[model samples]
Target: MKKTLYSLFVFFFFIAGLTNVRSQDISLPAPEKTGGKPLMQALNERQTTRSFTKDDLTLQQISDLLWAGWGVNRPDLKKRTAPSARDFQEISVYVALPGGLYLYDAFANTLKQIHNRNIGALSGTQAFVATAPVNLIYVADLGKLGKKEGDEIKDAELFWSYANTGFIAQNVYLYCASANLGCVIRGLVPKDKLAPEMGLKSNQVIILSQTIGVPQK
Candidate 1:
């Protein structure tokens, strides 16, 4: 009986260590730059329109969009085009494609597949969300922010979260302009229901979403 108990304890301890390592491995890397059009041109022509063609974005285009949105632009990773409150860097982008749902691994510059096949139905009340070739879902992890007391801190955090999201949205618009794609920043979805569908933790909040596709001519 003593031997069995000792072995069981060792096994559980090993399992616990493995779980911790796995979680750490899954943390996102800082974004990397993908050489594309000049920022000046992308910014000059950027515009938001809801009308999109029923065509998908290529992997390259998706990559560039993610990079522009929040990918690291410098070696130190201290600077990003999008500002995060207190360097919490809590914002995460979930890419919804006809093929399936994926989380953008900015550091890896790769799309990590989450679900197999289209789950566009998850974006409620927005038929465009279902039809657009790609939908970018911006989720903010509140746990990353330092704990605080009072509504003042909470309100400040909320504002910063939305502001960070806008930075990403504008990046997408610029990418669309440069690539001749159609895009729109949407805030119409029911985030409460959408959050569970994306398999997010209680601390993760969906702040905004956008649709990207070829323009209907």
Candidate 2:
């Protein structure tokens, strides 16, 4: 009887886990694309901030941050807020939060829940990464650029991707500055270990990661 009860317990636990993953599709409200501290002021305030508190970000902040990073700005042409190489728009932002991992769907303005695991720590080597409010993993999907599934993408082919990610990250930095938030774009990421955790394809390369949260005073 004890053995039979153990099986039932495992079955219920599995069902609860699936429910969690299905619940993270966040349909963010319309992003405010205008009225900030002006371009020149935002540029002056754009600086890297590392220290972070464990404060959770509000839904509006999350929406604004993702929108500023890569939301669709032009509905007619489907152009994003940040520029991409040849308009490839290859970079995919995977967010690791306390609840789970999610992919930021730029066009739909929603976060597609990928898995029910807190993989934020895998985003960076820093201790605070595990507990930060948000960690944005910038992954370059080569398949969008005509690369096949098993094609070995070289570093040379990734030059444009790296440059493209920088533009988006810079946008996030500026947004955080304007919002009085703290953020840092980090390159010291364990890609090989994190890629599998993020369930990325072989052609999808993780270029960099950025951590964001309230500043620790």
Candidate 3:
């Protein structure tokens, strides 16, 4: 009986360690920069899709999608694929996957784990959000725009942030179109509920969320 108990304890401890390691930051593969449908073809195919299969996006696909969305293109200038107002670069992309929540570090090309718990259902109000394999949350840091943590943020002040998010979202859309993936830019997010879950600071604001996955046939 004593030997059996010791074995059980060791097994549980190993499992716990594995879970912890799984939640650590992920170094994404270098994005594939070349080769996709022609620009005009991707534009022509650009569309919104709501039905997504439960199939998960491969690591390569995730890396490429993020690069297309907002990754750094001109490393020397530290410029990104999507333009930001005054180059503020206030919008940050947070990824909600079945495994956990992660923030995309465009410069490092890494996914910084925010938490291990899956928060897909909390990402949006639609039923598809919960089941989708990937959900991209766009957050704007008002502090970067000169607002203090407690300062009241106005809609006018967020005009540029909204515009920036649009640029990034569109990039993702075109990438999806080219990759034959399904995606939808969503506005029906429960921000009040999600902000805390994301552990966002008072100055960090949720701008939009996009759901992505394989198209359900």
User: Candidate 1 at 94: error in angstroms?
Assistant: 0.5
Model 1 clashing residue pairs (backbone): 31-71, 31-72
* Per-residue lDDT of candidate 2, residues 26-129 (tens digit): 77788887777888998888888888888899878898999999988897999998999899999999988888889999888888989879999989898988
Q: Report how far residue 173 has shifted in candidate 3, in Å.
A: 0.2
Candidate 3 residue runs with Cα over 4 Å from true position: 1-23
lDDT values of the candidates?
0.75, 0.91, 0.95
TM-scores, each model vs. reference: 0.76, 0.88, 0.89
Best candidate (score: lDDT): 3
Put down candidate 1 lDDT per residue, 1-217, tens digits, no spaces: 9999999999999999988645433333333355456889877777777777777766777777777778766647656666776777888899888877788777666677776667676764767677778888898877677543221334455777898899888888887888888788888878877877788776677888888888887
- Of 2 and 3, the candidate ahead on lDDT is 3
- Ten-residue region with minimum lDDT total, candidate 1: 23-32
Ten consecutive residues with minimal summed lDDT in candidate 3? 18-27
lDDT of 3: 0.95
Pitting candidate 1 against candidate 3, the one with the higher TM-score is 3
Arranged by TM-score with the best first, the candidates are: 3, 2, 1
